[model samples]
Target: MNVRKFIAATARDALRKVRETLGPDAIILSNRGIPGGVEIMAVAARDMELIVSPRDSVRPPGGTDAPAGGAAPELTRGADRAATRPAEATLRKPASSWRPDAEVPLPAATARPLTDAPPGGEGTSAAAGAAVVPAAVMDEIRSLRRIVEQQLAGFAWGEVARSEPVKTEILRQMLGAGFSPRFARELLAELPRELDAAQALAWVRGRAERGMLTIDGESDIVDQGGIYALVGPTGVGKTTTAAKLAARCVLRHGARKLALVTTDGYRIGAHEQLRIYGRILGVPVLLARDAKDLRATLHDLRHTHMVLIDTMGMSQRDRMVGEQVAMFRDSDVRTLLLLAATGRGDTLDDVVRAYSGLGLAGCILTKVDEAASLAASLDVVIRHELRLYYVSNGQRVPEDLHLPNRPYLLHRAFKDLPESSPHRLAGVEPGLMMAGGGEGMLSVGGQRG
Candidate 1:
């Protein structure tokens, strides 16, 4: 393989040289800082094809293929016995023809991290001579790429801070509020790029609110009564949210119009808890253990104006989640995934993904009163396009479940963290976070699959 080396003062310049010399499809093998500048070793994309296919053994830069007798003379030298072994035959290269410049120490990227033998151990010399690249080398290349990207991100961030201080501050605030890196970056990417900090922040709020899908009073679930189920991961307040919705339904259309059902046979006091709430509002509570039971219960309550099924709380990773979803699949049931406002962004994302298959009618934000920031919850809701049905801030059944207050949620989402708080990112950390987002940072839409 023809592996060419390029040295330049900066990573950008070295990359440009690689692209110009080897075309855009060039594969970067390794790169690192040297005494004068950075050194990058790369090979043509086409050349990499030869390395993987053992039949097309690695050929020297300007030499013919080795004779059928065996590898070239230099490969069988006394000091490099490993190269002569049949095990290393496919990767055998004439040692005399290929050698990196001696100006610097060996490149760390060439070493194999996964092999039983350590990177610089006995077999490394033979492994290096073998042209087939190991997975570890690719990982090293990716690590270097990330480092370069981070450096570039730091530079880009500095430029933005100097030229667009308001935009920079808004980004910092969004990240501090618990919004995902990609979400915050996408929103900021579309900002007018000319507003002051206050104006920019307002713009961000407006954009976020517009992206949010919320139900108004006219389309309120209670007013449009139907058989709805509250589903979600364990301890996200599914039973509590169900009771809140039940109370709201009772108040609007009367207790006779509302019925509560519990599928939580696993939890100790699950049925009794919903039963207590049912008694308070003069609503009857029913229990359904499985899909067939749920269908029968729904059939029996066909005349009831509204039926609220409080499902069993299970981990999002549990296989029963699919069973629960399947139970409501063929029925007229529309699911409302209960999301806890206090959950982490990734955890909330997982919950949304796990329950999204229910053809979610919408979602209810539970435990809002306890969340430090609503940014993470709002992030998942907006990205998944889940209709925001209600917000349950407190345990109070009828009073706590209220229509989503868009302005208040937005305010809470973008609210900055205290400067003294350890959770708050400071200095160049925001830039690093955004940079690490990679291709996601460049994407305009914030939605994720």
Candidate 2:
């Protein structure tokens, strides 16, 4: 048997060369890809007759007949000629007729050896038989590891450690808006490494999950024939929201079937402002001084399909907070808490707590167009588990207020920001920094710090 190793630019070409030089009977011992292409090792039994053939002209056909000193020169010349010949042409030649009776020598086995050895030999022999990974493959793996380490070393992992709170706050807000924790984590993980303020905001918007709000499938408003109050803190557009609903009811049930009621008797021009809306919509406006007056007004409008109650904006700390809640207690009326999208987090919380006594049927989110983070308002709303009834974006009656749709609300929560608002790291407040074990903070780059 004879063994040979071959290297070529590709695996296919190397295999072709082996077959040509070693004949069709050659056995492939090993083949593998290397940096340059492929390497193949093969073995073939020597054709003894071919060795003595005229083409070789090395040993005499009669075997060992030539003087030992003369044989060396002839053998060296034959080897040189064989090396110089084209591999394909050599492989095309016919086998020599001078066959030898002696057995051919066996080539050393190139197969990966077994590592499992009988008991005592395990330690030393098994180690020796272990398969060796090629040097080229080892080098490639090392190079990849180095590249990853270098890239990671340049990142500011320390900043991420400090900003964990901010990321948590962002995640908390997302969760409060009805996003699942798993979905939030997956999305936040993909945030970019660097961002400006506008970019960070954009990243937050992009990473937020959709479908945060739930909508009532029934399109028609329930006809519970008593005063339905719109109560909330200052500047939440209650007056406008009431007008929009009044218009909708009138459009569906006729002007005579609807009435407008104002319990905001304290605010200057509150009655007069609603009066103006009443005149245009052609619905009657009634002024209620107290809960007793409210009940009386309800009785007067008994024929009405809907009666919209607009209350004066009150501070959460105002002594009148409970008074307003009392106004709806004994009446056969539904109450709604109105919230402004532009209001602060704490302020929204106060409003919700103040209105808790009224048995709020649902909530109306107003001034969405003016808010920087609508999710903040939504966070408060969903936390209380209040059904969202309507959303008002502008002052336009009937046109601006829309029946809140869950999918639409989710889209708003996670929609991408305009190109003008990129995320940035500068001007971030120190208080915004996340404390250890607190909620994670989303950085301007969309990454949790």
Candidate 3:
């Protein structure tokens, strides 16, 4: 028997070389892909008799063939072919020179004929023919498992130890309000590590405790009586929030002191929506087409104590953002940018930037009830240093709007008392405690507790 090695750019080329050099009867031993190309091993025999009738004839001690039908040939010629072959070689050689050996060891647990057995076997075969797996393969598998376990353990510990207190508080609030825990967890994990684990957790808890509709900025201010415009992007509930604030003013002052103005002629029922709210509240509703018309309307309603202007919902991409800004210019009306809590950070920034030319008084956050997290909104508010005035939750007027008191807002936003745990009220003050609270009661009096 003779063994040879061949290498080629591809597996096909290497196999072709073996077949050409050793004839079509050459047995392939092994083949593997290396950096430069494929490597293959092949075996061939020189004697034609050894290649033919391999299973039936055996080579005696002097290389003479045994007589036919005599107690089976002892050293089957074909057995040598199987013995010389490697396990990794998938292709089989021609049966012309192959034969079964009388003393060939059978597979340990085969129920079928040995002919159906896989190429690699226990006896009368090369060590490679058994296809024994290398130790490195097992090592690689174990290494991968360890790496995965390390990653999971790190994540779990960070979540429970470092991130648990704050995340737990925030998650409790969100879950209490019917949010999916899986989604809440995913969002929390994806939050950028801008704040430390403690601060991030605290921020999340604050958002949950504050409720979706609660505002986080200054709300108490002397009403400088004049026309005030509420402007924001499309679908942020500006009209509804306007009605809420107007209702609050009317309840505090009187219906006679308030008037409603709308500049949303783009949508069919936009004007009617505000008009219906005005009618229910017993306030006058006026429409302004442009800056000149807005000026005229302001003059017409000069006697009104507070004029609330509800503008149309315009896309940030709309060309009309500039037009709207121009209309609000040089007017006594103070503009409040209404931001939706669910809006992306970049979109929020764009809205604020586009409307900055209008001399914004501050920002009013709407649809707080619909947001999963308020970090993006809070970041915008704090980064721009814009005062937050009101937060609106529902469509109900005078009920959903709240004045922003930082400490109170923060306390509510961060409040999460575990029901099963003992109330840890060690440092709490009497004024900070709620009227009917026990454990986890937070009291805010315009200062940190």
- State which candidate has the highest TM-score: 1
| Poorest 10 consecutive residues by lDDT, candidate 1 | 89-98
- What TM-score would you give candidate 3 relative to the actual structure? 0.46
lDDT of 3 by residue, 212-297 (tens): 33333333432556678999888888888888878877887888989999998778888998899899889989888888888999
lDDT tens per residue, model 1, 238-329: 88888888877877789999999999888788699889888889999988999899889999999998999988888999999999989999
Query: Predictions ranked by lDDT, top down?
Result: 1, 2, 3
Which of candidates 1 and 2 is the stronger one according to lDDT? 1
Which residue pairs clash in candidate 3? 51-97, 78-99, 87-128, 206-413, 206-414, 210-413, 432-443
- Give lDDT tens digits, candidate 2, residues 1-449: 46699898644466568778887645455555467656777665343223223333333343433333332333433433332222222223211111112222211221324333223333223222222222343344334333322222112122333444355345444544433333455555655545544565456664442323445536445343456788887877888888888888777778888888998877678789889999999999989999888888888887777888899897878989989888789887889888888876667878888889999888888888886556567666665678788888898879998877655565576443443554312222211322111232322223321
lDDT of 1: 0.72
Per-candidate TM equals 0.73, 0.51, 0.46
The CA lDDT at 433 in model 1 is: 72
For candidate 2, the TM-score is 0.51
User: Who is ahead in lDDT, 2 or 3?
Assistant: 2
> Which has the greatest lDDT?
1
**Off by more than 4 A, model 2:** 1-213, 217-219, 222-226, 415-432, 436-449
Listed per model in order, the count of residue pairs whose N, CA or C atoms clash below 3 Å is: 0, 26, 7
